[model samples]
Target: MSYPWQKLGLNADQQADSVLAAMTDGEKFAWLSGPMAIPLHKGEKIPAEAIGSAACYPSIPRLGIPAIQQSDASLGVSALGGVRPGDHATALPSSLALGAAFDPDLAETSGKLLGREAFCKGFNVQLAGGANLIREPRGGRNFEYISEDPLLTGIIAGHNVRGIQSQHVVSTVKHFALNAQETGRVVADSRLNEAALRESDLLAFELAIEIGQPGAVMPGYNLVNGEWASENPFLLSKVLKGDWQYPGWVMSDWGATHSATKAARAGLDVQSGSNLDECAWFDHPLREAVARGEIDGSYIDQMIHRILRSLFACGAIQHPAQRGTPLDYSWHQLMAQREAEQGIVLLKNAQQTLPLPPELSRLVVIGAHADQGVLAGGGSSAVTPQGCLQLEGVDFMGIQTPKVYHPSSPLAAIRRNSLAKKVDFVSGDSIEEALNSAQGCEAVIVFAQEWRSEALDAQGLDLDDHQNLLIEQLAAVHPKVIVVLQTGGAVTLPWLNKVSAVLEAWYPGSGGGEAIAGVLFGRINPAGRLPITFPASEQQLPHPKQVDPSTTTSLPGVKVKGDIFQIDYNVEGADVGYRWFERQQQKPLFPFGFGLSYTQFSYDDLQLCQSSDTVTASLTLTNCGDRSGSEVIQLYIRPTSGRYPSRLAAFRKVFLAPGESQRVSLRLEPRVIAQWETTKQLWHIVAGEYDIFQATDAATPGLCGTLTISAHAFGYRVA
Candidate 1:
């Protein structure tokens, strides 16, 4: 008696159901909870040094189902047992850097490399492809996210997912809904109205799911509206499953689960806990709930089914999983270097200070310990290089800060590439020392950095380490001062007017040193753009202060007493980043999609054509300068009928040579121009004249063309 699913040759869903039928109640419950405590090196329990098995899922040998082995792969494959000598993974630039690149092809390449590296290290599931939008600049996890704009974030993260999945490894796009900040994260409720949620945050997830087809999703630690994301029915069941029809299984962030029955019932398929914390919420409690009739057996079946479905769908079972395999470190390093080069945005280049003149004799490099290696963002995304030192202190969770410094030396690279014979260095030993070193130098390059990570929000937009004062002092003394910022996201530049040049290198990865050298010496043209708006000050932000009376902090063994933080997202609606700044008529230090190349480009021949549900726009771009470079052509839609003030519809990164011209056509998707109507609970478009702008940056209305939609033919997509 062959089952219908079996006769159909076992697709993922069907195979999952068949496996569910064979699973006993105990087996099903075991499958739903993870990081099974297997002995490490013949010990009875997991070793203290290795926090949790790199990945774990119980094996059902009878069913020929292998245990799922996954690793935290946000940046690269995380050093499973910490970054010991000769233990390193490719440290790609931060996701925000990739966002700045505004190139999905690079994002896809990154995802593929991530998958290959994780697979080589014996992992089948990759906890990668984080797509949370940059709602707050000071948000600690900003480095891990894609961009502030939903369309960009969704598209980039989607391509990343495609690259990872192509390697036959399950990729997880995560922190499921409205996890915009790290302060009061565990208990904060992201309270947004239905319309706002649908348009911005949820829309990003929806687009990513449709494009990427990821195998797993990790719901965040925060609460959506009033409910925890792990147990939020509207978010997990209705939005993710019911509406978008996401095929992936949903997992909880380590220690994110509160209740087994609630989470399981609300559509959370697995509870992946940390080895440091022995309590598995979805394990015994779920089994007991089933025994006590608190949770139906069908929910347990669904949980197991989702996990197995992803494993089968991603071909993890079909491929061989191995550990400690040798990798092409040099090739990966070179790619990481290229990613850094493509993503570093030249914010300001006054006086032609950059592409440093060949006649330069003396040059000074200051701060960020540039002689060693470039800095990296902290938290789960921090990739420990081969020779990195493991810091002694631990965060709230027993996670160590990676002090891994890759061997890419800025001083060495600059000396090797530049014409400057005398290159001086200042490690911020003292203001006086830095000042002395800067005297009479042809040019001064100051490298400033901000240390950001999980479990903590930046104090404010101000550069820490009094680096602002240092830049001010340097600019005051030196005629030509270039400030190279190594930050996670946007930072307030107090000395914006003082610096001759400003480059935003958001945690450039291992190859960052060479990338920076290439840009400085005119070897590579800077093409990266700002993924988020850089406010002049925190006063310009929608929420001037992210923490309020409702906010409270949580630590490993510390107790907190206060009302849970209520982060109101409805106040601004879908006005995130540039949208918020635009509505307020505030001036930002740097606008979104803003980047300066050594060569200039011109935008012309703006054309717009529309159908009932889609719009096609074309424009011409020409490199006006003598050098060849790349430009990101951004398309925005401003509906006269009053939806969003402006939204990014589509974007294309184009490369052009000297005196070269190219005509580019972009297809605007229906959702890009549609508004989520709260009353009707549907996506609707009002028939009106839409202004289409092909611009260099958000602040510039480069070449505007209007296209009118027929009133009688107005389209309402019931998504």
Candidate 2:
């Protein structure tokens, strides 16, 4: 049976007729755009959309259709109820932290937590984080991007989207087409090669759409190929809808919708964001032109019809329960802990420093972050984790846990575990103090958290005075030294030489403390791989700091002593990521997918299956060590330098058992026979040479396969 929304509103086919039947001439005029209000947030202050009547408040209520409120969220939903913006909620960590955790279940839990918050808080939808361009590391908004690589971003974020939408709250994957560089975010035209943008940047959005089927999508403020994103039909309709069949509403970036006719024609459905919501577009000359036979009313009807369709599809009109309750915070917390425990990459495990045998009576924990929780990344995605996590020595053995309360910290498990015995907890701001306490102790674990806050990104990649010095100091004193590095992305680590073990415990959400405890004492196996390249040093990155030569403002990095920054591309077109370094034989701190395990695994029995259009490679993976663990199988297909340069073809995350072997397979797409026509801008599959590789690291290809294909051109370029 059809749902109630089908008749109350109209089915997709009858949407245009339904909208026309419901709207009068006056109503049509009012639906265009609202007028702006006074300003509020900007430079030297907080980042927020709704302020005290700031940025031109719109008259959306006059439109006949009750306007639905929306808000920005890089992490949890921060929606204010009623006509005026209300209370402030706790902000969570950025996406950079989630990327480090590298666990999908955890990501979904976070999304679920935020979605319920939106429903309870009275917001209609949230611009769920961002799927913008990760053009360069120095890009101001890089912290929001999950990874430079698209596959990793999609797999992790897709689950999060599903979690949100599954809760019946609308999640909008945002900053739509190529808003990669932040310097010129709202204005800069991202002049990128079409295929590169399609395969890398756009690929991320496409994957999210495939996985989550978001209820709405917010257009970016920038211009792609000389046109604003909200007014680009080629991007919204041709690619997102026609090809992907995305049945969701499209809203403009706050203040981004420029024209009335053009925006409506570009497949835009809602205009409640910035200018689209506040501008008096309906009464403007351009919209009047559109209504008085100068432009097609059919276009306007199409947009309004799309909006009605979205409201109906999301069940916003028919059912309240569809959007789930807001009490799932604890559930999400548990899920996050599980993911963190699972993906915290065991980078280096020397002489069994980890899983410190339970016999150790006295354990020495150093670093200020040990007792203090540091959950999630910084900036817009930030969420205030409710209560304090219990930590070792944090609770007086005789006294109930003294909640080490910090708004953003993630300290818990230890506080509860110490109930059995009094664990020694010491906080030292310097290495000497921390080392002295660790001397003659059973084990020492240092929480080396690298914090990157707003206003300024990380100044450099070195450990701070206490962190760097303490690593060498504590390792010498404590026989078992475990180092936990937490940050958005990888930092060049020289301390690897001193520490017996190193763990990349990327910002693991609210339950980070519990996850850390579980991993430390061996509750779950670590299985995350670095999505971004871990450069040998910050110097290995492009010098001028911009990833593309097309950018304007230069970013911070090593400059000419006195020069703040200058726009220049020293790496040129050749030296790009792991490709440049690995292909050229310069060693990286760690390969792209290099993560250690508690047990050893072997890859063998390489086999290949080739088709005219694709290739499939298969290999056998067996756990040869004493313990059971999981591993991520990375497949990198580098084509012979004929058409395009080398790129990552396919990747898969796999699990295995001790003394157990499993067969694994990966599929390679049609790039094998295609030379993307750069000048003419088309993909033509030509007879080709292909070099396929399957491995655990970028530098090492455990298996090699080759294939040839006939010149087979694809049917079309939907994108």
Candidate 3:
């Protein structure tokens, strides 16, 4: 018997309707919820046919529906605790690293690598494409997210989703809305006005959905305003399903579903990892609700229709995932290395301290397990490559998630690259010992790390006092002190003036050591730019301290409940990251889009053109130094009279040889220059003169121009 999808000339929607008509209530109910594929606790049995990863929806043989096999993460195909024993996957650098590259094509390529691996491993749904804006600098999962800016996050995440879907895998652009912090995530309410929400967080999701057309969306565990995101009507129904007309299904984050009836009505199509919740709310309770007439049966059919449509649309049904499919692991490793090289942002290079002199007599490497392997972020998104070094870490929901270090030794790579007569490693556990060992060394390379994960935020931006002291001591004695940072996000550099060079290698992935070594030796020119701002200190933040939910009393618009607290996002509103710095007249230690290259670049011939709804900025960019490198040209715009400060309008990363020049034009997105009109529920561009600046970073403007746009209001086209 041929299925509706098998019939000639049937679209995804029509095919879904036909398939839905053939499903029984039990079959439909089965598709609505599923348990975590891997057992979280001892004595809990794994599902018989489960693939043992994130979650799995059993197939309906009679209806010709294939099982939805899912995997964890954004960087790579994560094998949670090695559920599938002896199985390993290639690891890409952190999402923050990808964001730093400012290359959408690279993002797509990374996504394709993840998709290919997931598919070959018998999984069709790769839980990837994390587009959440980095509102909180200390956010634990910031490494998984793309950028602080909405436009950058959206474009990169959209392309990533597009790549994943191209491999017949359904990708999810997630956490639905503002899931900024991990501390008290299940209880904290992210409070923001409609206008602010639309302009910042939602805008990112909007553009991602527009570009990626992903097959699924997953809501965060937190609450938006006063309602749980999984059951928030305004978010799931109004914005996602109503105005945007997103046709894909909505899945609840693991253990995120609170209610069966409310959530279903609010537009949550699937409840994943139901075992983690107190009960399987979407199972019997949902079926009972439909039978009692509390929920219309038609809505159930609609939910089933969405799931089936996505399956047919993304080719999950037609091309079933097959295990044991061969992959070119060596080629994948090279690609991962290339991505890491592109993302290693050079934050400081005082007097050209980097590209260490090859003929040095002695060199010493200290701290951060550099002698063993490179650091990786903790928690669910962590990819454990073969030969990884596991250290004791935090316990996340009864699971012991150890801090993993991929077996790519920076010491080994550096030794191979260096022509030093003597090369040595010191653990840096003792400052005296490290200093003693570093005595008479030609140079010193200090490796510092800050490990962040899914369940907690960093204590603060500063490196540990010991590490700080170690650097200071080393700097006082040595003339050249180069620091290599392996962190989830930005960190305080108290010893900035002392250090000669600093490279922010954000949790560089599988081939990180080689990438780091390549940059240090000038074999590869660093081109990565900062995706988030690095404040001088925590005191400069909109909220100096992250609100501890336990200590909080009450919020303006929210009803105080036991354990439930509110985060006032209205303080910063739509202005986040560098924009906040601009508004507050604060100078960050390092600004967004700031990165140093081995070579220099200069801009000229700045011009601006305006159309009915968009503005285009064009300029000639030339490489002015003696070597080849890439430059991230940033365009920022601000209205002469407006409450909002300057924002990132458009950006492009160009590569050039010495003295090579190219004219580049960037067409700004309409939403970047417009504000959300709350009452009208549309983006409104006020008629005014806007100042545009060609910038090397958010804080430094080079070439400048102005453009006048006529008054216009427009709504987004429904996907």
Candidate 4:
């Protein structure tokens, strides 16, 4: 009566026999094909039968085991029937906001929250973490991605994974290996040299594995080299299972399995989101491989064993599944507010212009998204929120204020706050009329949100005319003016000098109002930094569309805009982030890792180590300024030889008391210093000298030391 899974309660050998005996080779094959659908952000058009009643355990019932199911995870739970069942949890700020926060512990908490939500939703498996570096600004899925920096992405992803698996839910660290860009992701071959991929794209995934140790790795949709990711034996069997020792099951991306035999042979233990047809497994290539004794019943059993191990490890097989109750709009709303508050970045605060004086006699607020909370993004990660906080802030505040529209903005939240004597709503009126209406106002607030996409790159770096006009008009009437940006990503700040204050509240979730209010009133300090570089102008970037493709448009419906590698890496080369600007002696509006806090921090006690095998550095960090704050210590390594122009070596986050200082260690494996010799087309290392820097920002590599690396270690050609 006991099933093989039940027998798993016994000793290992017995359990193995129990599982093997219960299932015939065919049943084992069925279990070996254990793959589930990855629900897209856009709710699926499901067949009703599979909705309320899931297709439970075909093999598990027969052999007494249960299969696992899951979903993509840019934000939280994917909605169903236009109802968000999981909104009771917080809709945390997008990954960019979290990255901007620059606090790993904060990122850890965010991940834990997401994990709790997943646990509540009865999801056995979820794509909880993976570092997909945002190589392109126009990357369609930028909101879901962390940052262009590998260290930041890895840290954030590791936090997220640690949170999920701690709740006993299997987390998939995914689009595994190299999947930096979304364009032609399914079919395009990533023409990457090993050094490029390893240092930039693949580094994060490797670091996540080293730290997070997730139970599942979803191979990408694209072809890695010439072979599909699903069937790349070199990648899966060699790199993943052999070298890295990743014992977890390898699941193909949804609809990403290119072939059955090769995929299985390559170490793909599960085919995710496959249609319920046995043809893929039972058909020609795999069957032939089996008949020829290349792959057999044992291989099939082993594959199922890996999957079952994952389920058991995550406690999905034996634990009592407690599905959560229906979603609560109010809880979701509050979560949105907290996230919005954390997400609001105080970019500039000249003359102490913010926390808009509570003694205001009159006020004018402006932007469209101000009232319409940015619920979600477009492309693979899009999902409709149950309730948004954009419109309701006014009535809650019980304040008399004017709601002025500047196309799209967050002035609505400001309008609802206290101290406004008379409220007036304005749209497209002349500057004279707008200024006249605000005659008695002591200060003005401008709401600016940038909405950009791969389909249409930013026309220019500047804010819209409506926003420009609104700021120019409002500043004339009121010497004190503050601008709040509610956008998916970055924008130029031409009017930044003109405004007294600037807040980058990137698409704050449902609590757009309360969160903004909290930051504005100094209830909370704005610590969010710009995850991506704010371009000085559109011309500053290497435009993909401008290349010699001579193409006006792309495939219909949805399409990735440009080759991120081509634009960001090849053409732009090493001139990325503060690296490019500083190297060229050009200035950025705000440098990478630049964020002004209500408090201040300082760095000291620089130390550098140069061993034969490694280079290490350390620094003493102190919060010299008032408020309790955190600072990210950046490390850069530059080889004296031409192997690498420059690269991030190591980094650490230090939190300090006002005037309290402590020494922290920074480490670098000499391997990180290895680079490719482009002329000879081989990886190279030099025993010659290299420079090390410990600094606040990449541009300001303030403290420096020297070391040398052996050229022999890296002198090898790629096959």
- Name the weakest run of 10 consecutive residues (lDDT summed) in model 1: 551-560
Each candidate's clash count: 1, 31, 0, 14
List, residue by residue over 1-719, the lDDT tens digit for candidate 1: 33333445678888778777887777776657765333323444642323243457766667766667767766887753353345668889889899999999999998889888887877778889898888878998898998999999999999999888888789998899889888878878888888788888878888888888999998999988788998999889887877777777998887788887888889898887644334677878878888899988877777677777887787776564556777898999999999999999999999888889765789999988887888777766668876653443226355445545556778888888886778988897588999999888899988898877877677898897578889999999988999888887889888899889998888888788899989998999999999999999998987777663343343222223355667777767788999998899998989998999999899888989877566899988999999999999999988776556788999999999999999999998667687777766677666899888987888887899888965332223343
Compute the lDDT of residue 663 as modeled in candidate 3.
97
Q: Write the per-residue lDDT of candidate 4 for residues 126-155, one digit (tens) a residue.
A: 665756776555554566667767766776
lDDT score for residue 6 of model 4: 66
RMSD of each: 3.8, 7.2, 1.8, 7.0
Q: Tens digits of per-residue lDDT for model 2 on 325-413?
A: 34555665665566556657788888877765554566666664666675444333444444444232111111122222223332346
Candidate 2 local distance difference test against the native: 0.59
Q: Specify the highest-TM-score model's number.
A: 3
Name the 10 consecutive residues with the lowest summed lDDT in model 3.
551-560
Task: Tell me the tens digit of each residue's lDDT in model 3 across 461-561.
Answer: 99999999999999999989999999999899999999899999999998899999999989999999999999999999987877667656543443457
Better of 1 and 3 by lDDT: 3
Worst 10 residues of 2 by lDDT: 393-402
Residue 595 lDDT (model 3): 92
Better of 3 and 4 by TM-score: 3
Which candidate number has the best lDDT? 3
* lDDT of candidate 3 at residue 690, scale 0 to 100: 91
lDDT for 73 in candidate 4 is 66
Model 2 error, position 413 (Å): 1.9
